[model samples]
Target: MLWVDKYRPRQLDELHCHPGVTDLLRKLMDTRDFPHMMLYGPPGAGKKTRISAFLRGVYGQGAEKMKVSTRSFKIPPSNSTTVECQVLDSPYHIEVSPADVGTGSRDTAIVQILVKETASALQPAMGDKHVSFKVVVINEVDRLSHQAQAALRRTMEKYVGACRIIMTANNFAKVLPPIRSRCLCIRVPSPTNQEIREVMHQIAVNENITVPDDLVDRIIAASGRDLRRALLMLETAKIKHYPFKANQKPPLVAWEEFLEKEICDTIMKNQTPKGVIAVRSKYYDLMGCMIPADVILKTLVKMLLKKVSGDTLKSKIVTFAASFEHTMRLGAKEIFHLEAFTANVMSAIKQANTSQQQGGRAPSPSGGS
Candidate 1:
């Protein structure tokens, strides 16, 4: 197993970071009956870990026994087509992401089907008598369409008796206000740099490996406060070389390196329609490989910010990037938005150059107004 999963916390108290959030979860578990929960945070911030620990506290060891199955459900109205959805099932809970069932109205149908199927049934009599309701975990709740989210809201209200819905989202702003109001929203912020360093040290001790302090600092800097990524970086570094060098840089995954070299470099050097077209092809290549459009746009913006010198140019690039990113989320064709963002950045750079060039031109010899 990878170090990220191997070092994962099995119980709430076992969790090293986010002590306040752990305390709140412990209190909720103590009540034995808590409201629906919405856990929102950046990636690798222990949202899923907390959920697992909370369930285990309520359902005991049975909650950890998990199995994966692909279940098919018929779409509503016509009831003619069936979509297959992968679900992770435990004796105590069922987890599914509606976005995984494919896009459009089908996601709404899957959300309705899964929630109704799981929530309408009463909890089976297991060894634990105090546990009366099962859990329905919906991952990537923010990606659900408006219709799907609306369906989820209705099901959540109707099935409050037999089950509880726990949702995880990277961005809570995308979730509808009505749904947000129904659940007890919990924000799990990313771990601090100190917290990440401590975890790295603990993992090193457990593995009996000597990780130099400088290498640990490098990993933490590259991880962006994501503990999971930090752990993965450490393991990858260890695998490459056992006795680590203090100056050894942590390796970036292939896609990140590719973006930096191929995409970002191309954008900086070429700022024209031809440049936009060339970048568009590369964008297609990346998307064809299953890299998400948002990840691509985000990395491109970050890299470009570092390359560009002036604050004004960087701010303009960020503004345009944010606008296009929001558009990408709402629109179907990601390539269009990605290309548009590239063009906008190129345009900004060109304008800045024009202003600089015109300002640099000396006054005419006649000095006439």
Candidate 2:
């Protein structure tokens, strides 16, 4: 199982930063009794884990009450320590039932068939008398089959007085309009750098992973507000090399230099337009090395915000930069996308040609307004 899932935050209070969101959730869950709430956020930004914590904390003893199927869904263990299970002799001669899998439409007819079965299995415990408070859950409800979602909508409404939905997704538009209208909506904004750093540090301490001061920035850079991704990077880095611990001198390069290297590394790949490869490579780099594309962008954003020499060209540069991100997400032919993006950046630089008359110099490394 991935370290991110393993190290997922279990309590609302433990979710570092975003206390505003946490505080609101706390009050709502405690007093308001949320109904079909939607939590939208970037992937890996603790959306699933947060809702899971809320539900488990509120209805753990009755967790099995919410199980749609007896079959397991390959959930990752929630902590760093390993768990092992061995085969045992069964006098009962038990038979194991395979889990229902895949999507509807194109996937298995069995998957479509099981939709009703799964819902039926869950419907009983979800019925009144068994449920005291609304069952809280966040899932990719957008991926539900049309029939399944319709059934789920009934479930939501039927249980609204008794249950609350905390569905989450990367794209909110994919969610069925009926489902979206039934509940409150909240955005789980991605964590900032300091928040990510604090998470990694806590996990490092809990797991006994050694971290160097210099290395912490690298982990934070790679996480991009995805705490799960950050924890995985920190664990893997510890497997490769330990970061400095508390009371020790931090890394020698300093935070500023780390930021510069991160940006250069993000864009300077010796690549031939495989933007998908580059983008995935960047994410993998963060997963394994703790360096992320957004972190690099933020450094450049600081430069642009500083209104340095290139700052004069920031407007156009930022525009094309956003284009680059959009193209990357849309699965354009990478070579073409990166080519256009890089050329646009270079064009912006060229547009500032008049500025060079002062010293023939590009912007200074020190970002400033």
Candidate 3:
């Protein structure tokens, strides 16, 4: 088992970082009318961990005993078509993601089917106990299609009294307004550098390894403040370079950084239609390898910001990137928007250069003319 999973905080009190958020969850557990929750944060920021701990806090240890099963459900009036969904089930709750509903054409049907099933389940009578409602945990709620989100909103309202929905997303902005308005939104910010260092130290102690200060700093730097990533990097380093050295760096792939540099340099050198054609192969290779468009755009923008010196030009470039990123989200063809972003930035750079060049050459008009 990966060290990340083995050392995951099992209970609410076991959580080391984000004490304030955990306290809020504990208080909510004490109440009888805890609202449906929407936990949003960066990936590996402990949103899921806190949710699991919160469930265990209210529903006891049984909530942690999870099992994965592939279940099939037929769309109403269509016995010919069925949706196969993988669900993580436990005694108190069942976790499902709309993305796990296979490649069925009618993806919306799976969401409706799951919601109806949860609503129809008999509410157990745990008189004076906290486990009255069955919890339905949905992972990656932001990735759900608009149609599925709409169906989920109606089901949420209809069964609000019987079942509780706990949704997790990397970004809450992607969630529908109706769904966002209904749930109590909770932001689980990423862990700080110091917190990540402490966690890494604790893991080192548990593994009976002596990680040097320089090595620890290297892991923290590579982690991007993600605790889980830091832990994984630490383990990877230990296995590859055991008997920890004083200056050993974590073994992590630099392909993202290299790709970012390649994209930015390609745009900077050739700010023309030819450049767009030149970079098409790079984008194709990435997309063909199943790299997400958002990741590509983000890395490109970040690299451009670092490589470009002028603040005004950087701001303009970022604005253009944002516009294209949003278009990528709404549209199906990711490469079009990505290529458009490169072309747009190149145009901006070329226009800026033209204005600068013209300023130096054009004669100034006489003030007293």
Which candidate number would show the highest lDDT if scored against the true structure?
A: 1
Candidate 2 ranges beyond 4 A from true positions: 1-3, 11-34, 61-119, 122-129, 132-164, 171-178, 192-194, 209-214, 243-309, 312-314, 323-334, 344-369
Across 1-369, the per-residue lDDT of candidate 1 in tens digits comes to: 998999899999889998999999999988888999999999999999999999999888889999999998888889999999999999889999888777767899988887788876665664364688889999999999888998889999998888899999999999999999999999999999999999999999999998898888889988988999999999999998878876898978888888888888888888767887887888898998999999999988888988997887898889888988887888888888887788777777777766864333331111111
| Residue lDDT tens for model 2, 123-206 | 433322244443434356556566555655666665455444556766777767887787787788788888887776776687
lDDT (CA) for every model shown?
0.86, 0.52, 0.80
Q: What is the lDDT of residue 16 in candidate 2?
A: 74
In order of appearance, the predictions have TM-scores of: 0.87, 0.54, 0.80
Q: Compared to the true structure, candidate 2 yields what TM-score?
A: 0.54
User: What lDDT tens digits, residue by residue, belong to model 3 across residues 1-369?
Assistant: 999999899898889898889999999988855888999999889999999988887887878789999988786666687777888988668898876664334557777777678767756863235567788898888888887788879988888887889999997888999999999999999998888888888888898988898888888876778888898888888888889876776876555645765667888878867788878778888888788889889878877887776776798789978888888888888888888788778777776766764223322211110
Q: Using TM-score, give the best candidate's number.
A: 1
Show the colliding residue pairs in model 3. Answer: none
Weakest lDDT window of 10 consecutive positions for candidate 3: 360-369
The list of candidate 1 runs beyond 4 A from truth reads 127-129, 269-281, 326-369
